[model samples]
Target: MARSQIQDVIRCQYCENEPAVFHCVPCGDELCPRCKVFHLKSKVPSGHNIVRLSERLHPANQIKMCEVHSSKAYEICCKVCQVPVCIMCIQEVHSEHAIGKIQDLYEKLKAETIEELTTIKTQLKSEISQRIKDYIMGEKGIKTSHEDIREKMKKQAQIFINDISAILAEALQESEKDERKYIVEIARHTAEAENFEQTLDQMIEKWETLTDSTHPVELILYRKQNPDIFKLLKLPNKLSIVMPSFSVGQINKSQNKHQFGKLITSKVNLIKSPVESSKHIQPTMSAKGNKSKKRVLERSVKTSQIKAEKRKLCYMACRDDRSAYISGDGPGIQLIDRSGTELDNISTDGEPIGLAVMLDRSLIYSEYDNKVIYKVALNKQKTEIISTEHNPGGLCCTKSGDILVCMGYRGTARVVRYNSTGRKIQEIQTDQNGERHFSDPFFICENVNKDICVSEWNFLKSKLVVLNKSGNLHFTYDGHVIASILKDRFQPSGVATDSLGHILIADRANNAVHLISQDGDFLSYILTENDGISRPYGISVDRHDNLWLVEQEKACVKVYRYL
Candidate 1:
């Protein structure tokens, strides 16, 4: 047998040879059959509490004897000294100091410490991980931008090869030199960020292990030794990469090759970074001195509203650029800036139903009319990626670059998971009882917890269905009972999730947005017509947790800060 396969044996405290089968709680000693008799007759009293070794209480929960008065267990907590004391010690040293029950103080401190640790862990998992992803994605974007500049240069060079071949060589060389320099710097920064991400991962693992521990003394000692462990870690500054630009001059054969366009080097700009998120976060505690309740989603403040060019906003996908791709009745998807100015337009085969942006900055759209899914490259080239049997309505790109598509034919609806190459991996349609869970999954998005949330609607009824990563039904939501009073039938449209794993569903009929917990319990009404939201169709939560919602009636996308 392997060493790891061997079970540890607990020897008797007194005999050391025999395995301990009994435990004296008050004496904090374990004894075998022979030692138990001797232990009972010796120092330990016969009336002392004895239990089976298997029933031994965790040492952390065990009553600690006071150092000054060993006969009495700690009963009072001195607020001035922040220490536990016995009745005798309180009378001698803590008589004038404020005090409370030691057990009550311990519970409060533990709750506060655990809440802080949880906050740190949440930041490490969401913020740090997102920063790492951003770093990597920025590298890819830089490379893509570089390739695009080079491709343009190649085309320009092909036109005037005879006149400026030598100068073209120098320009190309200079571009390569700049690329090498910037790529190296980016690689170094990426490595540093990755190392920090790893450290945060280790810290999260340590927190998990510590929180799992049942020993109170160890937890208290750990907190004392590492006072800052519960606090949020300071992450590195956010750096923005500026894409290099090339100024192309008029192609004049008479002009010298030196007059050719020059390659401007890319720049790395440091932006004023916000820690974790925009909102100031503190350790949440319950007023009733209980475990912290689940975070509540409150009505958001409408910050900006941009009028989209499209008449009816079908879908909206956002990028790190603060720009969004809006698709509607037209056969083209328009990329619009934060101010709603159209920057570029990519033509599609048909009206794009589902639009999503991948980590590589590529765009994916599913066309219901063509029954096909297409990928638009960074160079504006569109190619058919997947041919679906059923019409594809909504789609999203996962963290792993996989695509989740919502497909429906007639009345049957299902969600299919596919790799970037269009290889089908899994399908979510039926439950354990073989009953269909969706009639028409119109919009789909994945939560930070990897739960796949889909808003399914048809003429009969509508609901929000969430499934685990493994395709098992996690939960389902049909509108809040009280909110249903405004409308008889639930009509769920677009769906999005925030870092906190709260699901935001667009209720088109009610002209509101419903916020629910990860487990499908309704938390609150995030937005309603009273907030000037009309026919909210599509919704998305950006990295900053700001909600980007599309109002069909208004023909605009609204940004809100709800956190």
Candidate 2:
């Protein structure tokens, strides 16, 4: 070889004048391309750890597996003990605890936090902006009206008016504080989310790339390695916006003296209950029906069917993300994704019949035989949240996070409300006349106005019952009375409400879904057998106002855009 060429060539481990690329760490040899291939192929040096010079190891990216159980990865975490535990460790010590895979837990937490973050952006943020705009826009009118009224009123009346002005000012300040609190929370949460999201993205990329590649040794070595970035998920910002109320009521004569009447400027947490609804909310009981049809109603028709397993769908509820849940005929509650795939199957003691999902994805279901209500956690753990005296039927979670269950049987039917922890808060049985409001109350739902709608069924009396939040019988609807059509009783099985204050009832016998206006007038038959809906029992409306009707006999959930 020439002297200059020989000097330029990096020597292989076994020979000189050979250009080298890879360094075998275990063999401690900088190998040329041919030697590296030979080393990987040879029996003695085949298992050596090799790395390219350009790909030097970073200490920060290195992960350590379980030390005690050498070579075993530690993927699972014992939440109760607050420690990382390997699968072997779970069988040894951390058995029967709230154990979760670090990756799974992080993803779940991220999804929830992101959902809330989106809510803050879309609903809370938009609502605050509109509220400010409304208040500001109305300020000029309010000032002009007040000034004109002040000239006409006495000094005491003017003082009362000034008091209202002060109240409005205080309301503005409270709203500003609310807006500022949300702004800070969003900023802090965004920063934290960005950091964690980037870290997770890199980790997931590495995991996917390495796991998919033919690196058996590295895969085996890091099989159970769990990242400690899990703590970032627990630090999620639970931003809840509490909208304030600023009301200026009418001035009524009391003891012939002028006073600031009903200045409602209470700043209440909106996450708990309904935010600032006007007193014009009429109970579903007193729902005044309109016989005259003014506007042409757009009915919901079956657009497509969800590819689910069985046709015997007893009851179903749509989650916030449009995922439909149903109780399997046998054991466990089934969670179906948007593609109709059973993403999760949670085992329970017995088969739950009626299922309901809260806004927060809390799956509240009822056990048919036992008449019990349960809340299903993310880890497939079942917690008995409500035990009813009567056999509980369908379950629904109110906007205030209260659980409403159909607790009744033949001859005695009623609706009952309970707190989260299986505690019965109140029971509604007979109405003001001491007469039973329902007979065989099966399915129930709470409206935006907190009204309870029950589908009461019996061979003798089949009717749809609607009561106000206070248990007052507002109205009772017996199916659409059309003698020309020769239809039987309503025999409503499933009930749900839409954003437009409309009550939807699924009638299995009639093979139709009756749309009732919020005021209790029969809007129209939104769905029928003609619309590819037959034996439609369990039904619900998704966020997009699309009707998800489960035809039990057909064993499918059909989606339709009505509203």
Instruction: Give the C-alpha miss distance for residue 498 in model 2, angstroms.
Output: 0.8
Q: Which regions of candidate 2 deviate over 4 angstroms?
A: 1-301, 483-486
Which candidate number maximizes lDDT?
A: 1
Ten residues in sequence with the least summed lDDT for candidate 2: 278-287
TM-score of each: 0.48, 0.49
In the range 1-563, model 2's lDDT, one tens digit per residue, is 59998677657766655777777654567787777777887676225567774453543123447865776656667877656677677775567689876656656656766766776676767877987897786777677766866665666677777887998899888889988887887798789878877888887887787779757777666655654445455545666756656576774568344333333332334343243331122121132232121233475555666756653677788874447787545766667866677867777777777788765566778876786778876545678776666777888888888888887686657788887666788888897888988778888888867889999887887988999998999898888865543266667898999766789999888788888887799878877766667787888877666778887776777787775
